[model samples]
Every structure is written in C-alpha cells, then in structure tokens.
Target chain A: MKIGLFIPCYIDAFYPKTGIATLELLEKLGQEVEYPMDQTCCGQPMANSGCNRDAKETEALFIRNFSKYDVIVSPSGSCVHHIRDNFDAIEQTDEVRHVRKNTYELVEFIHDVLKVREFPWAEFPHKVGMHNSCATLRALRTASMSELGEPFFSKPKTLLSAVKGISFAAPKRPDECCGFGGTYSVTEEAVSARMGLDKVTDHHDAGAEYIVSADTSCMMHQQGCAERNGVPIRFIHIAEILNGARS
Target chain B: MSNKPVPHAKLAAEFLKDEPHRHFHDERLWDMRQKRDEQMHIMPEWQELREQASRLKEHTLAHLPQYLEQFEENARRNGIHVHWARDGAEHNRIVEKILRDHGHSSIIKSKSMITDECEMREYLEPKGISVTETDLGERIQQLDNQLPSHVVVPAVQKLTSDVAKTFAKYYNTDPNIDDPHALAEAQRNAARPVLLSGDTGMTGGNFLVAETGSFVVCTNEGNADLSANLPNLHIATLGIERLVPRMADLGVFIRLLSRSALGSPITQYTTHFRKPKKGGEMHVILVDNGRSERLGMDDFWTSLKCIRCGACMNTCPVYRRSGGQSYGSVYSGPIGAIIDPTFNAKKFSTLPFASTMNGSCTNVCPVKIDIHDQLYKWRRVLAERHEIPFVKREIMKMAGRLLAQPTMYRLAISGTEVALKTMPRFVLYNYLNPWGKHRELPHPVKETFHSWYKKNRLNKAKQHEETQA
Candidate 1:
C-alpha cells in the first residue's frame, strides 16, 4: 500500500525525530511510504478553534497534497482525528472523501490496517506510562475508555506489549487529557498548564521513567510541564519507541 | 448585561491561585467520577440504561406540547394548579403572584436550580418576601450570598473553614469550628426557625411524569420533602424538559439519577408529589426560560435531555480543575458551557471555549447529552456570529493562510526557529506569552522534518527515479 506521511506542522518543526521515527518504522514494515513535502498540517488548529472557514484553504491544500495516496498516516492522533472527523470545512469531493476515509494515526495504521504486532528491532527497558490522546481514545476508538465500563482493550498497549523488555507504569487516571488541546494550551494556559503538570506528576509518582504517547502535540506540552515543574520524568512518542530508540 | 464575555480563563487562573482549594475541588469531583464508574461497573446494563433514558427524553421533547398538556390536565385532576412561564421574568412573576395571592410573606425552598435561573430570590426579596434554602449545601451557599457552583453538591468547592466562616457571620457560630458536623448543626439550628415560620413551600421537580400528572423530587437531605409539606401552600417549579412519559419511565431515571449524580444507589428521598395534602394548595410552574428556543437548535436540542445529574461536570477534567464558579453562571461546568449560551450568546460565549473537548463529559452523561460535541459546535456558532474576540479570529485567519501554502509555512517555521534560538529569554517569556506563563516552550530544533527529508529520503528517491529512467 502507498502511504502518504503527514508531518503535522509542530512535528515538522519542533519534533523532527518523531517524524523520522514514523517514516523509518513504516519503511521497516516493508510498506511503501512517501512523504509529500508540500504537506504542512491537517488544518486542526484553525478548525478546532471554531474557524472552519479559516481552515478551508489549509484543508483543501491537504487534499491537494495527499489525494493520490492509498492511505495517509500521521504520528499525531489529533491531526489524523481532524482529517477523519472535522475536516469538513471544504467541499466534500471524491478526493476529500477518499483522504478522510483512508487517513489513519500511526498507531492505528500499524495496529489495525497493517496488523503488524511484533517489533523485533524495538526494545525499551524503561517503565513508561501510556498517554492516549483524547482523539485517539474516544474519537478513534483505539482503546476502551474507563468511563464506558467495557472490557478493557488498548491498541497502543497491545502494540507496546509485543516489544521486548517493555513494562507499563499505571497512572491513576491513565487516559485523562494531557491538556495540550491544540489552541487550548495557550488560550487557557493556567488550567491547561495545571492539567499538564498534574498529568506529568501523576505518571512520575507512579514511578514512570518516561511517558509514551501516539501524538507529539500532547508530549510537547507535557515535556514543557515536566521540565518547568521539576518533575523527574521523560517523554517519547510511540513511533520512537516502536522504531527502537534506545533510552 | 455588558456584551463582554465572561473571562473564564482569568477567573480560572484566580481559582487556581488557592492551591489547597484547587486540589480539594479536583479530587472531590474526581472521587465522584470514580464512584460513578464503580456504580457503572456493578450495573452490567449501564449503557443500556443511558440509551433508554436518552430515547425517552428525546421522545418526550419531540411531543413536548402534547405531554405538557396531558400533564397539566391530569395534574389539575390531582388537585394541582399549573402555571406556564415563557421566560425567567415570567417564571419569577408567576412565583411571586402565587405567594402574594395566598398572602404569604416567606417561602422555604429546597435546592432548586430553576429558582436560581429565574433569579427568584433577587426578584422576591425586594417585595418583602424571604426565601430560606433548606438543603445544607444550598443553605451554605445562600448564606454566603454566592451562586451554587456544582448542581448536585452546591458547596463542594467550599472547605469546612469557609463554611464555618460563612456560618459565623450569620448563624453566630464560631469561625474556628472545623468540624463539618458542627457546621451542619449550626445551619440546622439557624434554618429550623426560618423553615417553620415560612408560610409557603417550594421544591424543584426532578421528573414531571406526564402519564400520572405527578412529579418527583430527589434529594439526599430530604429537603425537597420538607419544603413541599411544611406549609399550606406548596409550589413545585421545573424546567419544561423534565417530562417523562410514564411512571415506569420514572424508575429508569430514578435508578440513574443518584447513581450518576453522587454514585449512590438512590437519593435519600425520592418523593413523589401526586397531589396536595388536604386543604393545602399545590402549584406546578413549567418554566421554559429559553428551553423552547434551545429545543429548536439543530446541534444543541439534545442538550435538553440533560437530567442535571452533573455527571458531565464531575467527569470533566476542565470543570474539575477550574472551579465551577469560574464559569460565572448558575449552571457551571460541561453542562453549563452548552446550556448557558442559550440564555445569552455573547455574555456566556467564553464558557464553551473553557472546555478541552476531551469527550469525558459526553461519556459520563447519564442521558448521553453529547455535551463536549455541543461545546465544539457552539464555538463554530459563536465564531460565525462574531461572538469570539476579534484578535483570536484574525490570528486564526493568518494561521490558516500561513499553513495553506507550504512555502510560507516553511518560511514561518524556519523564522520561528531562528527567533527562538536568537531571542532573549525576557523577550521569549513575557506577559504576552500565555504558553510561557506556566510552561516552558518546546526547545528549538536544528533541523525540521522537512529539512531532514530533503537531505536523506528525497535525494535518494530522486536518484532512484533517475536510475530507473
């Protein structure tokens, strides 16, 4: 399958290592992956801020860049979520529909579409807490949320379990938002930062050496919180771990 | 009202300044959320109950006029007087008239959020009518002259010391008294005389059963029962959306209400008011207040399905972290963020944006109100109506334009990188930087993915293409 790699603007700039990991991981799985250099973002920031009309140009450009690929994958769950769910600012043409239907977050792409379980090259000895972005947990249904009282299942955890020497740290509220809600982190910085501090502290107190998540957006905010609050914790994207980054 | 939006973020920042209070508030609500999950875990059919409750609410709302008429007719047969209120002003007027017609000078009411919405106390106080709150939490809030923050636990955000201070001011209790039981006793002592002296009683209806022409009031403290039966004149005011088709349907709600609200099996008192006691007059006022207009909203109509169980608020991380008072409305938290907009779009515009849109509120809602989704939709509605701040809108416009063109986006990214690398610490972290106010900025990177791809994969792919050609 031809996979179009969507490097969200933040990943493209601040967290290039995550983007690199995603590309390498896909390549290692023996799938054809293409990074369309023209792609910048999935238009989540504009659309999520209630400026859908403002999002139209970016969203259209997104379709223009990735229309021909069989599937579009991003390391950011929120960006993929925006494309799959809220990418409605532009007209619903066949190309738009095709991109929306085929776009997948990196974890879901590897777990559900590719169905690749074992990561032979990946081994993480550190105890890590899994942070599922709200978009990945609730919107994408990648895992069973605690609120639903359903049988417990986690796609991210499932994939991580397959890795050698990987143990999970259980935070009290594992799936609570890390408060890096695109524009929300700045707009409501006090509450947003407090949530991020609490989130990092929760994992830290649970004895986690590092926090792993599928979305770089959340980890960016959380790393800032951890560093500022003097919380002794580290952060990594799921792609980095799955692609066997030694820590 | 000034057209200025409520500064929820500012108020929340203020709330967070008191670390102990903030910690207590977050933990207390989180405990309720956990208990609610425990209740759900035991009930094997919890999701099914939510579906039934949601469908029943939607059905009744669809035929609201018919159910309302049926309720009015049957309630009259049960010796109840019914009144219709088109808005908050009308609802207050109806209540005031009921009190004045009976020559009543005082009313002892239960914890009714509808009365708060109608501003009944503010309206009636100048008319020489006194209202006393019988619920412990509400009485604390009433004595403190503050709005009820959480719908279920009105004083959940208040510490024991705060209550002691408030009671000391009014009930002549010691300000240093730290025991909650003693504070409750103080309130009970002070309110008993007022509860006994009041000539009229008022309670909020939790459910208005159309089939039986009766209403149910669920309270942990049995305050509603006392408020309804203490005087010869009883008034039950409820929002129009509280109707259930039959008594059987009431069981579904009753089973879900306390479990969702407080994680208890049921409230201490789930009293059914089918009729007035002999020689006592009974009145039921159905208040629309903006509910009819809200019902007409395409994306927001399902919000009426809210039973006000407050599960959404308890489960909401934003609501838990930011104290409920920060929302600056009678209804606060996830439910309030959606409902408050219906009252005044401009004044409460900031409420919708107060959420992180985490979707926990929607998951925890007993009736499945889709609260977080409504918050998301409300932002779109407000933006289209120009209710959002001009600066934010303009910024988004610029961001959209910058992101649409890859060339400009790359330029801006590199520009940001250079600025971050070269800018002074004072310049980077200043009053204007909300992100830097509490958190550090992401570290500057040497090469972005775009640059890395160009150097590594893009060149290789180009070379391969040439070789194949």
Candidate 2:
C-alpha cells in the first residue's frame, strides 16, 4: 500500500526533525512512504479564520496532491482533523471524498491501522508528560477524555507504552489544551500565551522534564512558553520517541 | 446596532494584566469543573441523563409555540396574569405597566439574567422606580456598578477583598474583613429590610412547566423565593423557549441543572410557583426577545435548548482565562458566543472568534448544545455579512492566494531562516507580531525538510534509477 506523508508548512520549515522522525518510523515498520514535495498546507489557517472562500484553492490543491495514495498520514492531528471534518471549501468530488476518508494522523495510523505493539529500538528513560491536542483528543476520539467519564483508554499511551524504560509524568490537568490553536495564538495572544504557560508549568511542576505530543504545533507553542518563562522543561515529538530517538 | 466588534481580545488582555484576578478566576472555575467531573463519576447514567435532557429540550423547542400557548392558558386558569413580550422594550414596558398599575415603585429581585438582558433597571431608574438585587453576588455586582461577569457566580471574577470594598461602599461594612461568611452576613443584614419594605418582588424562571402552569427557580441562596414571596406583587420573567410539555420532563432537567451548574446534586431551593398567594398578585411575562427569530435560524436554533447551567462556562478554557466581562454581554462564555450574535450580530462578532474551538463546552453541556460548532458557524455568518474586521479579511484572502500555489507558498516562507538570523527577537516578533508579546518564536533551522528531502531522498532515488538503467 502506498502511504503519502503530509508534512505541514510549519513542520517543513521549522521542525524538520519531527517530519523526518515520522517518515523514518513508518519506513522502519516496513511501509513504503513518500513525501510529495509540492504539498504546501491544508488550508486550516484560512478556513479556521472563517474564510472558506479563501481556503478553496488551497484545499483543492491538497486534494489534487493526496488523492492517489491508499492512505495519507500527517504528523499533525489538527491538520488531519481539518482534512477529515472541515475541508468543505471546494466541491465534494470523488477525489475530495477519497482524500478525506483515507487521511490519518500518524499516531492513530500506527496505533489503529498498523497495530504495532513493540518498538524494540525505542527507549526513553526521562519522565515526559503526554500532551493531547484538542483535535486529537476530542475531534479524533483518540483517547478517553476526562470530560467524558468513559472507561479510560488512550491510543497514544498504548503505543508509547511499548517503548522500554520510558517514565510518565502525571500532570494536574492532563487533558487540557496547550493553546496552540492555528492563528488563535496570534489573534488571542494573551489568553493563548497564558494557557500555554499554564500547561507547561503544570507538567513541569509534576516533575516532567519533557513534554511529548503527536502534534508539533502544540509543542512549538509550549516550548516557546517554557523558554520565555524559564520553566526548565523540554519538548519532543511522539514520533521521535517512538522511532527510537535517545535523548 | 453598532458595527464595531466587542474588544474581546483587548479586554481579555487587560484582564490578564491583573495576575491575581486572572489566576483566581481560572483556578476557581477549574475547581468547579473538577467537582462537576466528580459528580459525573458517581452517576453511572450521566451520559444517558444528558441525552435525555437534550432530547426533551429539542422536542420542546420543536413545538415551542404550542407549548407556550398551553402554558399561558394553564397559567391564566390558575389565576395568574400571563403577558407576552415581543422584544426587550415591550417586556420592559409590560413590566413597567404592571408595577405602575399596582402602585408599586420598588422591587427587590433575585438574580435574573433576562432582566439584565432587557436593561430593565436602566429603563426603570429614570422613571422613579427602584430595583434592588437580592442575591448576594448579584447585590455585590449591583453595588459595584458592574455587569455580572459569570452566569451562576455573578461576582466570581471579583476577589474577596474587592467584594469587601464594594460592600463597604454601600452597606458600611468593614473594608478589612477578609472572611467570606462575614461578607455574606453583611449582605443578608442589608437585604432583609429591603425585602420586607419593597412593594414588589421579581424572580427569573429556570424552567417553565406547561402541564401544571408552574415555573421552577433553582437557587442555592433561596433568594428567589424571598424575592417572590416577600412582597404582595410577584413578577417572574422568562424566555419563551423555557417551556416543557409536561411536569415529568422537569425530572430530567432539574437533575441535570444544578449538577451541571455547581456540581451539586441539588440546589438548596427548588421552589415551584403555581399561582398567586392569598390576596397577592402574580404576573408571568413570557419574553420572546428574539428567541423566535433565533429558533428559525438553522445553525443557531439549538442554542435555545440551553438551561443556563453555566457548565459550558466552567469548562471553557478561554472564558476561564478571559473574564466573562470581556464578552461585553449579559450572557458570556461559550453559550453567549453563539446566542449574543443573534441579539446583535455586528456588536458581538468578535465573541465567536474568542474561542479556540476546543469542543469542551459541547461535552459538558447537559442539554448537549453544539456550542463550539455554533461558534464556528457564527464566524462564517459574520464574515459573510462583512461584520469581521477589514484587515483580517484582507490578510486571509492574501494568504489563500499565496498558499494555493506551492511554489509561491515556498517562496513566501523560505526567507524566514534569513529573517530569523538577522532580526532580533523583539524586532522580528514584537509589536508587529502579536505572538512575540509573551512567547518566544521557534528557533531557525539549518535545513528545512523540503531542502533535505530533495538533497537526500530525491537524489538517492534518481541515482538508483540511473544505475538500474
């Protein structure tokens, strides 16, 4: 089966290691992965800002690029969520429907589709707090949220537990948002920063040396908050740890 | 209506400037959310109860007119005067006429958001009538001359010290008093006399039951009952959407209301008012006030199902960090973001954008209002109507054109590495960039993934193909 890797714009420019880790992790699991270089973005910034008309051409471009693959996977949960749910800018052709249906966030893809149990090469001895982006937590139904009193189940934790020597930090408010909402960080800068600071502080206070997540946008904002406030915590992508990064 | 958007972002920024207030507000509401979750944990049928309440509300909303007419008929037969108000002005007018006809010039009222929405006090104060808020938090807000920042806890945004000062100004209490109980005692002492001497009393209806022509008011303070019973004249105002087809449906709603609101199993007072007391007159004003028009709105009608439990406010991260007064509406937070625009679209346009669309409000809603989804829809509606700001619309359009073309998008963002290296942090991301005000920008990378892929993977694939050929 063909796998199309979707590296979002910020990931492509700033956090290339995360994109590299996702690709390498997929390949290490004996999957054929291809990064379509012409991909720019998923039009989330436009559509989220309530400009669906402006999002049309970008969404069309995305559909044109990813329609041929058996499944399209992205390292960012928010982008994948937009592709699956809110990518309604253009016409709903067969290609659009196909692209939307086959799109998956990398963690869910590995946890559900690949169903890989053990990462023999992956190990991290440091204590890290898991950050679930709102898209992954609520929109994607990835894990049992604290809001819904269902039996506790976490797909990301299920996949991460396979790694050896990894310790977890239990924060006070584990499932709260980190406030890296695309464009929301800039638009509502004060509250967004306050929330990000509060999130990293919670993890740090709970003895977490690092915060890990499947979505890099949240980590990027969180790292910014930590560094600015001298919070003394680090950030990493879940793909990096699952792909056996030792740091 | 004013076309200017409420300065939500600006006001929230100002609210954040007060570190003490911001932390207290966030932690206080977050504690309520935790308590709510604890309640959910005990009730195995919490989700099922929420579903039942949502279905009941939707059914009532679907046949709102018939239920309202039925309620009016039953209420009239029960010796209660039923009045219909098409708008806030008419509601205020009807209220004024009722008070004037009864020769009453003063009213001691409980916390009713509907009266606040109608600006009833603002309208009546000019005409020699007095309005006193009887609920403690609401009384503090009235004394301070500020809007109730929260739906359930009107003075939750104020610190205890702030309350002491406000009370000291009005009730001659000690400004140095730090105890909440003492403050409550002070308010009680001041309110008891006003309750007795007031010529009229007013209460807001929590649920209006059509089957028995009775309305329910749930309060922890029992102030609603005092406001309704102390005076010979009683006035209860409620939105028309509060109707339920039968008294049995109250079982579903009453169970969810306080549990979802304060995480308590039940309110201290759940008074049911069926008819007038002996020789006392009772008036029920069914206020439409744009609810019928909102009911016709396809994307927004479900917002009418809200029971004013304030669960959405407690769970909303944005509303917690940004004080509710920042919303500049009587109804604030997630519910307000959707409902306020129906009142005045241009005035509350920025309200829908105040959220991150995290969808927590939808989960915590007892009646299951799709609050975040409605907020998104409101944004699209506002933008379509040209209610959004000019610069934001233009920037989105520019971004759309640039991002659709891959080459152009690459060209636009490719300079960021150089810009990051040359520009100082403040110069690059400070005044011009709202992101730099409180957070550091991401560090510059030596090689972006695009360049690395082309250099390594693309070249390796070409080399393998050439060798094979």
Candidate 3:
C-alpha cells in the first residue's frame, strides 16, 4: 500500500506537471506515497554514454534514497530500466537488490499492481496516438512491440481505453522511435531531429490532435520538433492525460 | 565531394538536407524492414531461430581457434587453397598475388562487403586488373564510382531513374528507360560478356562450414554463381568469425538470413562450394582485420557474430534517414555503430553516439548481436579513454555533478523558464546548442516538482500530524 515515487531528472526539471500527475494518480488510487526529494536521477545519461565512473556516484545515491520503500515507482520506464537492469557498477548489496527488484514504471504499476479497470476520475476528449519509447516498450516490456510476433498488448493503452472520451490514432509506424534518445537529440542532431519530425508527422497524419507517451523525454523531444517545424500536433505525457490535464 | 572525414552527426545533417531524397531513401529501406516483419510473422518460431542462431554463434566464437584450425585442415584436404590474412593490407596483397600468379587481368566479383572493406577494387584496378562487381546494386554503384549505401541492397538509396542514367553513361543505353526492370535488364546485359570473360572471380561467403570444409554464399541474383563458376581462378574472402562448427548448422542461418536480408523465402542461389572445378583454383582467405582484437574486448566480443545480412541497417531509423554513406565506414547503421568504435576509437568515436539506442536493431538481428547495448557500452569506453568530443565530455561531467546533488539541480533549473521566455531565440539556438539548430528547446516548467511536492504534500502531512495529535 505504501510506495516511493521516483521522479526522473527530466520530469522534475523540464516537466513538473508530469511528476505532480503521477503523484495525484497514485494517491487517487488509494495508495500511501512519499516523494524522496533527494532522488535526482537514475544515472542513465552517464551509464549509457559509457561513463561508468560518473554513473557510480548517482547509482549509489539512488540506492541510498529509495532502498527503504517496499515498492518504488517512476513515471519514466527508461529511468527505472536504468536502475533495475544497468546498475552493474554499483556493488550488489542487499539494498541494491531490493531497489532493483521493486522499482516499476507507472503504467505497469497501474495495470499490473493496482489492477483497477475503472478510472472514474480520469477523462480526456482528444484523438491521441501513443508513442512507445524504446526504453518503455522494448526495455521495460511495457507493451508488445510490433517487431515481435507476441500477442499484441499494451499496458498504457489498456489504461487509456478505460478513460472517458478518449479515442486512439493508429499511425503507420506506430512503434518507431521519436529519436529524442537522451543526449542523442543534440549529439546526432540532424538524424535525431529528422526522426522526431518523422514520428510526430506520422501521428499528425494519422489525425492525432496530440501524441501521448509514457516517457516525457520522448514527449519533450517530439513536442519540440513538432512545434519548431510548425507541425500541427501537440504531445502530452501519459501521466498528464491520466491525471485529466485537460480539466 | 568525398564526405571528408567528419563526425557522423555532421555527415547525417548534410544527408538530411536533401529532404525529398531523404524521405525517398527512408521509405525505400523502411519498406524492406516492413517486408522483413512480414516474413518474421509467417514463421511462428522466428524468435526461437534467432536464439538458436545467437547461441550457435556464441559457441562458435568461444571455440573459434579450434574451429579455424579444423576448417583449414579440412579445406586443404578438400583441395581448396586456404589463406590467412592478418589485416586489410594483407588480404588485399593476397588477392592481388592470387590474380598475378594466375595471370588474371580481369576479375568478376559477387557481393562481397569484405572486399569493399579491404578496398580490394581500389588496390587491384590501378594495377590494370579490371574488377567487375556483378551484384546489380554494387555494379550500379561501381559504375557511378560510388560506395554502396546499403549492404544488402547496395543501391537501394538510388531511384530507377538514377540507375537509368548510370546505365546510359556506362553501357550506352537510353536514359529515358526509367522502369526498374528495363534498367536492371540493361545492367545485366552489359554484365554478361564481362561475367564470362573475366579470368578471376571473388565473393564474400555468408558462412564457413569447418566440418565439411565448405562455405555458403547466398544471393538472390545468382551473380555469385556466375562469378564463382565461370573463372578458372576463384577467390572467396570472409571475416574469421564466419566459421560454423558443422555443415548442418547452416540451416538456422539460411532460415534467418534471406528472410532478414530481403524478406525472401530463400535466396535464389545458396551455393555451397566445397571443391573447385577440375584444374580451377578456389582460394578461401580468412581475414582478421581487427576481428581478432575485437574478440578480446569483453564488452564488444559478441559484435563479431554479425552475419553481414544488413538486417540491422534496414531496421535502424537513423541509418534509414542518414544513408550508409554518412557512416564513413564500410559497415553502417547499428552494427557499424558498435563495430567501428571497437576497431579505432579516435576515428569512429562518433559512431556509437549516432544511434538513439532504441534497441530495434537488437530485436531484428538474426544473430542476436545486442547492438544497441554495445552502442551504450562503447560510449562509456570512449569517455574512459577521453575520446568523447571535448565540449560534450565536459558537459556530461558537469551534468553528473549537478545530478548527484538535487538541491543544486533544483536551484539551477527551477527558474529556467524565465530565461527561456526572455532569452532571444538566436542566443539559445546558435551553433553552440546542437539541439536548437533544427529543433526548439522544450519550454521549462515554472518550478521543480520537489518544490511543489514540499508545499503541497509535505504541508498536508504536517497538518495531518497536528490533527492526529
């Protein structure tokens, strides 16, 4: 019943509403929650760039702040994936084991743990297309990606369908990357921008008024590209929509 | 312009400028990727085959030395000449020597990326040896004096009209014949005489069977068969990692290779050459060329298991848009991102950063190379060696510092919105900020979530404590 909220650095700094929405949604589902303010990030940017030494400091810090909670939840599947799957540099003590074992992304937590089919408080009246972040879809296994022959299911979509006045837009390459890719958006700027434009353009062509995703890092990247290129579409974090941001 | 040695980011940026061409290039490769998915779906055991192929490759790599020796001994007994090349220079020298010893002036080639990697044509052509690339795509690229943009479909980036012009220039055909079939026919007709008269033939093998001392070369066009069969002197080049333990094991790779390569049920010609024709010499050269050194790199050893099918390239969003030429390496796309960095960090350091680390390359790989994971690991290795671009490296270091201390991060970023709103776009979107060049920065939130949570949740907790007391 008690949960610790893990706000990834991007959500905390770039999009505070997402963190607030995550908190509100968890509370509305009748769970006791605590926000560990000392928790800054999951050390993915460092670890992914091959800077193990840099990642170790944050890795140890993450375990220190979130080790006590029976279950830790984050709005970003990628950050949770970084903590659970890629914290090899940190010593594998009991606390590290507990932190890695219990962390969950928001959709998976709601769909699998909360197991609540009804969301009486949630309402969104827009045609939205889902952008499956690589970390969330492929890394966290939050959904069945189009690549595999596995029976198709999406933890995020299941919850979205339960929300009132929401319709889904199905794009041609629905599962392709938005290409934010953390530092890649800047480092490989042109390809990254082209990828983001392609993804946002696809959703817009599919008639989505807004593109929604589980990872705000992707949302930020796609939204930025959409706005700059004058693409007539908006991006919303799944948490914001689930929290009834429109209201 | 020769795309002068530049970072992949810059090269990709320039490549994306031809917006219409880039979109055409993107859709052309994506269609292949979609077709590959169709093939993958038909086979219910596609995932199982990938696992089996990956495990087989891993076992072969782990026991590679023993397998190589067994292959050499068995190949020699089968009357196939075996050559060991320590590097690209050696591989090229050996190929030249074979042509010289056999008195061959013209050589015909079947789609061998290894030869491209060794720059064999560049080495051989200047010395009066005519090297003809028989694969239609490579031949088109060869005539145009261009490198292949995609390995499997070497000229896939080109349109039918582009090939029509290239054919007209080289073969004296009508440039007006823009139909795909007409252009292909012209190229094929021009190739027939060259295919028959060439005194030497060369190919890149898909798999080497150490058990039977046989090698398999799969191609849909049957060009490998023509080049391989017509010449009295035949040469097959392969990376040392191409060896498989047994001939029977070819089943798993064959099942995955064509389906993953072009989504074909099977290649038109899957030729197994255990022995050459009477009085003809068939030489199989095993080229190391940094592959042996890569096997020692624990973080990247699995990368050597690549089958050169180009499946990863087809599926890579970055590669599809940027084109393989942007990679500035023979290997491009996700596989190139991993393999290039392992060989020369200073030269290929930017390659690993080219990917978004989406892991789609990992899923589609028939050999299960775990390509995206390797890209991540390569980035870390580059930073350890201080090979990351200087400014980016320092920025990452600073980020690590700020991220470890939440209060400082909160203080620094919470009020970032005011700067975004007031700051001129030119100042923020200049050359210094790569993200700002073609994309806008995300508008910042009013305050950090920590500040909001403290005021809202922490205050409520305190009020509840007072009420309970």
The count of backbone overlaps in candidate 3 is 3
Residues B1-469, candidate 2: write the lDDT tens digits. Answer: 3557799999999999998999999999999999899999999999999999899989999988888889989999999999999998999999899988988899999999999999999999899999999998888888888888988999999999999988888889999995999999999999999998999999998999998899999999988899999898999999998888999889888888888888899999999999999999999999999999999999999999999999999999999999989999999999999999999998999999999899999999999999999988888888889888899999999999998999988887888878987887669875888988899999999988988888889999999999999
- Assign candidate 2 its CAPRI class: high
Question: Cα lDDT of all candidates, in order?
Answer: 0.92, 0.92, 0.86
- The positional error of residue B312 in candidate 2, measured at the CA in angstroms, is 0.7
lDDT of 1 at A13: 88
Evaluate every candidate with DockQ and list the scores. 0.88, 0.85, 0.74
- Sort every candidate by lDDT, greatest first: 2, 1, 3
Which 10 residues in a row give candidate 3 chain A its minimum summed lDDT? Answer: A48-57
Please give the range of 10 consecutive residues that has the lowest summed lDDT in model 2 chain B.
B421-430
Better of 1 and 3 by DockQ: 1
All candidates' TM-scores? 0.99, 0.99, 0.95
lDDT of 3 at B339: 86
Error of 3 at A25 (Å): 1.3
TM-score: the better of candidates 2 and 3? 2
Model 3 has an lDDT value of: 0.86
lDDT of 1 by residue, A144-178 (tens): 99999999999999999988898998899998988
**CA error at residue B100 for candidate 2, angstroms:** 1.1
